[model samples]
Target: LNSPESIAVVVAKPIYWLSVALKPIVSFLGISTEFLLKLLGVTVKEEAPVTESEINKMLTEGVAMGAYEEEEPILVENIFHLADMNAGDIMTPRTQLKWIDLNGTEDEIMEVLKNANHYRIPVGTDSLDELKGLVTVS
Candidate 1:
């Protein structure tokens, strides 16, 4: 009775009998054995983690299959693309940038900064080409 096979038989016999006994009730209720096990807080299987490439492929396929909204896949794809982007790729062009003039009055600088709605603004001498330093607007 202490042997491994004996122990297995001892442990498996009750489970086999239980399944046999529950089969008819399960059939009557039209529910799967796995579903019943889940209701009993039993996990049947565990899913492995997906890689980034797999996730990107799944998102592409899901969008093509119309399983996801256009915006949803686009957002996920953008996140994937973000890893490949450098600062130059995401930075604002110098022509469109806002800066605080170093020679401007404090009130004028504050007004310009307020209108720009920027947290860290670049401070320059006369133009952007003449770099002074960075100013943190609180």
Candidate 2:
């Protein structure tokens, strides 16, 4: 257990468990740092690393960390290639959708907007089977 692999396994266990248990809480609070710490059974300690002395103290104490340096940037050939991934692979889909009949009168369209709080509404011919252009009510 003293090897690098063992150390990685030990260190990764808590982080993985923390991420799994905190996912719902993180989603509930919209991924805010303050919320994340609370969800992770930790406290948010704020210490400014503004001054040279403060920065040096942070580095020495391992309080603040530096970003990882990568030799090459990540490249994506087709974003749809990511479709093989499931919901957990990406952020939550928070889309607000409203459907309207394209042949409907202006008043009908306005009525839909008045009832629902949305900026854009997708126009459909008959049912949602046929989709037309989008309408902006704002």
Q: Which of the numbered candidates is closest to the native, going by highest TM-score?
A: 1
Each model's lDDT comes to 0.84, 0.66
For candidate 1, the TM-score is 0.38
In candidate 2, position 53 carries an lDDT of 50
Q: What digit string (tens of lDDT, one per residue) describes model 2 on residues 1-138?
A: 459988897789899999999999978777676677788999767886576455445444442234322311122213334756887555433343566887889898778888866676778997766987777886
Question: Lowest summed lDDT over 10 consecutive residues: which window, candidate 2?
Answer: 68-77
Lowest lDDT sum, 10 consecutive residues, model 1, at: 26-35
Q: What TM-score goes with each of the models? A: 0.38, 0.30
Enumerate clash totals for all models, in the order shown: 0, 0
Candidate 1 CA-lDDT value: 0.84
Error of 2 at 31 (Å): 41
Error of model 1, residue 18, in angstroms: 68
What tens digits encode model 1's per-residue C-alpha lDDT throughout 41-92? 9876788899887987888889899998778877887897998999888887
Per-residue lDDT of 76 in model 2: 24
Give candidates' CA RMSD values in order.
Answer: 20.1, 17.7
